[model samples]
Target: MSLNYPAEGRNYIMDAAIHGGQQIGTWYVALYEGDYTPQEDDTAANIGARATEITAYTELTRPELVESAATGGASDNTGNLAQFTLSAPKTVRGFAVVSSAGKGTNTGKLLAYQRLATPRAYAAGDVVKVPVSLILSNPA
Candidate 1:
């Protein structure tokens, strides 16, 4: 099962096994700052929307599997156990599973944005481990 998501000013396809789409291999992931409404201009280089991104994400460059395909999702979302140790105050509303690592000046494809079940508000020295998952099915 494949779904088309907006990425790099075009539609990027994903095999959403949950939505009857075929499953694929590894994909990159990133944590976007809360209130970051995804836009066409978003790239691997910028976590836009005046939203402050948390760079403490340990697996910023890891290619992980789609943890479990949801039965009615629009795309295949690979879930990962992300742990964050914040050195300053922060609030994270959601995350993004991208097609490539936005390291250096190269921006990759933006797969989808998964909002936290509950927004997390953290203070200095706070440690939070999030089970961030992806939903590529049921396009909005």
Candidate 2:
């Protein structure tokens, strides 16, 4: 998974992928801490012993660096499954971010995670809710 937080921005962009390590889960499950994956890079491990050492140093344990908030006004993805960086880092198997309406017609409405979901409203102090449990992946 990768998160793209543009500099000088107030909205954070996030992306995540599932490998072969994730377990089956139900809906509406929230992932907590202590489920992070701490594995070294695969390529580094294949390049002999010395390369493995270097790769270990460059390994990324958590996906926090990818989360960022855009500035000059926030970005909104209303009625859609928007990708927002997780401020509290944890490498789970699977997760999703849900948002409640900030104002206007969508105020206080429950938005499900679907393609129809879009970031329609962007604002400061907006709440980002991660309502799924994250599966921790093992090292390759």
- In order of appearance, the predictions have TM-scores of 0.55, 0.16
Best by TM-score: 1
Compute the lDDT of residue 109 as modeled in candidate 1: 50
Scored against the true structure, residue 3 in model 2 reaches a CA lDDT of: 19
Worst 10 residues of 1 by lDDT: 1-10
**lDDT to native, each model:** 0.51, 0.23
Residue-by-residue lDDT tens digits, candidate 1, 1-140: 12223464234443353355544355654555666555655654564333445665434443343455556642343344545566667787766565555432235555655556567787877765545444443335
Candidate 2 lDDT over 46-106, as tens digits, reads 2122111111111132112122243343322232332333333233232222122111112
The TM-score of candidate 2 is 0.16
Question: How many residue-pair clashes does candidate 2 contain?
Answer: 27
Where model 1 places Cα greater than 4 Å from the true spot, the runs are 1-10, 14-25, 45-50, 57-66, 69-80, 102-106, 115-118, 136-140
